[model samples]
Target: MTKAHFDDLKALVVDDNAHMRELLHALLNVLGIREVVEAADGEAGYAALAQYQPDFILTDLAMQPVDGIEFTRRVRLSPDTPNPFVPIIMVSGHTERNRVEAARDAGVTEMLAKPITTQSLFARIAEIVEHPRAFVRCDSYFGPDRRRRHGDSHSGPWLRFDDSAPDVVTI
Candidate 1:
């Protein structure tokens, strides 16, 4: 695995479930991330954002008070914000097309489905934080032959294409 530039990285994990929040925190810690903050939901997540300027954020789509999409929009559009350019990742159990599309419209950098594994989480984080513009092809994570667009400079992961993998394809 290629070494990530995670030395200066700090992350905030937001979820309604305590277990989910803790799971994300633990995963990030294992990835060598030093500063990890937890929020119960979007409201708390936003509050944390105002206080701590994290390098990245991971939030759940479904929450009690506020949902993930709105939270992401607020962060991206809010002026005088601490971390306006901070990459926001949305985690959801919902695999519905509308929810995913809405998350994209709300300015989410990436989406991770439920039962998120360490590799998938880190892969999504790395893909966006490292190469902001090069879109991930949604068809598959691995390649028959991957392609890059004009002016794109970075190379992404090369996973073994398997029919069984849950299509961690980016787009």
Candidate 2:
């Protein structure tokens, strides 16, 4: 991406750890994102959104009062918030299958594991800018389209007792 792509873009970095927040600040700065807002926890992040909306959000999954999932939920579902469709990247050291799934279900645009590299970090940001997902609102979901691709199997095809997979259309 060009400097024009990220220059002057506002971003929020929410993490309880001071070092992580600083590290994110540096990463965002390298991307030419000068306006980086920070919060110690999800509640502060929510309040910051009200005070001023950012183009994107980078939040931790675990925190006191409110976690990243709850923060994302509010942004996607709460009427008190200004925008429900902000691009959010959930960052955490936890890269387990369950944690990643939780991040996806929480409406995050992307999930980045901790100790983020320059290349991976930029790649994630670039993906967000280049490919934006359309928002979806349903009784059980209200956020970006959860499906990443037409053929992505969020849940594996149905299996019979004989272990034969069902012919299921992914899309």
Candidate 3:
């Protein structure tokens, strides 16, 4: 993708570690994102969301007062949230299945493992820009559609055990 795609984007970097926040800011800059806002933790990140209204968010999984999971939940479920639809990409050193599932269930738009490289970061951003996922809301979940695959020719009830269709709302 071209740098032009990111030229006008604004991002929020939320992490308890100052070093990680700085590193993310620098990486965002290199990718042609000049307007980046940083927050010390998810609590501050939530506040910044209203003031900055960033196009997207980059948050760490672990933090005090509020972790990324809770923050993402608030962003997607809070009545007073400024921008519930804003894309959130959670970054964490922990890539365990449980942690990944938690982030996904909490409404994160994407997940990026820690020790992040420029290429990986760009790839995630590119995916967000190029193929924005439609949001789905159900009694138990309110977030992007969990299913990533589309147009699969394999038609079988085994693919999706639950025949019940989720109420989908495209954003």
Candidate 4:
């Protein structure tokens, strides 16, 4: 597969730790993303979004006052959000299933465990670019479709309420 070019993309890095921000900045630079904005925490990150209007966001999961989950939620749900559709990749040391599920529920496009590698980071970015998921809006959620796999084949009964069953007799 051909390497994807990210020279034109702008990114926002949000982490309370300065060193983590620096590391991510370096990685992003190496990936050819020259325009990067950094925020020390989620609150700052939220403000920066309006000011910088980044094409994507990489955020740490834990922070004071506001964490990455809250950050992603605001970006996706806030009325004044600069770009609700912007892709959000949450990077965190908390790899526990509950934490990961929380991030997913908050609308993160992808999650990368801490101790990130160049290859893994690149793969996530490429996945976002190559297979962008369609956004879904409902009473409780407004984010990318939660379901990752899509096909007509199913081992059990049809689950989607929108899909009509061929064997059902209409009244």
Candidate 5:
């Protein structure tokens, strides 16, 4: 039997390496997902999330400036804006037990070893998107259809949309 597909959802693939991003982007498209966005690094990932609010996020752990771990922490802890608790699948070359443990502790929904295959990626995506709260706390965070709550703190990562402070929005 074939599994149910969520063809309407959008996804963000974050990685500094151009080839990796391209690979994942292609894989996602092959999965019957058409709306896939790309981010060069954690900063770009956050920006894409704020602007697009993709249904899911696939990010690489190792990157310059703000790494995946830090990015996850900031996304989880940020206040003001309601976060979607989006499922964040973090990928890395370090597959040691301790490293995997660390990634889990840092708030990643799932961890995958490098040299990602289509089977593994699709399987994990199915698992994650199937569960209502697979990666994030959806009710607490906002999605495309979800409405924004009053008093929701938007003062965290993703973007610096400070109600009090002003900053530039860059690509």
Candidate 6:
């Protein structure tokens, strides 16, 4: 799926800041996404997601009532949503390892920093559409495959054997 073919795709922008929401709404328009829904927080975002079956979701990490992580968890784990496998891209100013890990654990498909660029935004969109990650389901987790790299099974110092794959670890 290319940008040219995304004119009909809808994107839901969830941000608590008015300015950031406006900025992201404009950027999505510039990206040829005409059908867009905006939300002030994760609670509103969840409502919007249920109201509008968007092709993808762009959300902020920190929010009141319902944060991005919680919203994503609901979207991925909730059985009442319109679609549980909808793509979600988390946008936040805090890019710390813990934040990123939390977002990933909550079922985010991608992470974008606060000051987003048109190129970077488009790249993430393209990556999600062009090279979508496979869906994974476990007893306590459900979302895109967590591992970004794969290779032959091996145990050595060069290859970190202790990883997400081949283990029953908590996300």
Q: What does each candidate score in C-alpha RMSD?
A: 10.9, 5.9, 7.2, 4.7, 14.3, 6.2
Ranking by TM-score: 4, 6, 3, 2, 1, 5
lDDT per model, in order?
Answer: 0.74, 0.85, 0.88, 0.89, 0.72, 0.88
Off by over 4 Å in 2: 1-5, 151-171
Clashes of 4: 0
* Clashing pairs in model 2, backbone N/Cα/C closer than 3 A: none
lDDT per residue, candidate 4, 1-171, as tens digits? Answer: 223665878899999999999999998898789999999989999999999988889999999889999999999999899899999999999999999999999999999988998899889988888888899898778899877765544333665775444565679
Rank list by lDDT = 4, 3, 6, 2, 1, 5
lDDT of 1 by residue, 13-102 (tens): 989999898888988888788799999888899999888778789999998788887787677666555655677888899879999877
Model 1 weakest 10-residue run by lDDT: 137-146
- Judged by whole-model lDDT over C-alpha atoms, candidate 1 comes out at 0.74
Lowest summed lDDT over 10 consecutive residues: which window, candidate 5?
142-151
Which 10-residue window of candidate 6 scores lowest in summed lDDT?
A: 155-164
Per-model TM-score on C-alpha atoms: 0.73, 0.84, 0.85, 0.87, 0.72, 0.86
Best-fitting candidate, scored by TM-score: 4
Model 2, 1-171: lDDT tens per residue?
Answer: 223655868899999999999998998997678899999999999999888678889999999989999999889888787788889999888899998887788788898888888788788888888998988788877889875654434344533243344476988
Weakest 10 consecutive residues of candidate 3 by summed lDDT = 151-160
| Per-residue error (Å), model 6, residue 35 | 0.8
Candidate 3 at residue 67, lDDT?
96
Off by over 4 Å in 5: 1-5, 80-84, 132-171
Which portions of model 4 miss their true places by more than 4 Å?
A: 1-5, 152-171
RMSD of 2: 5.9
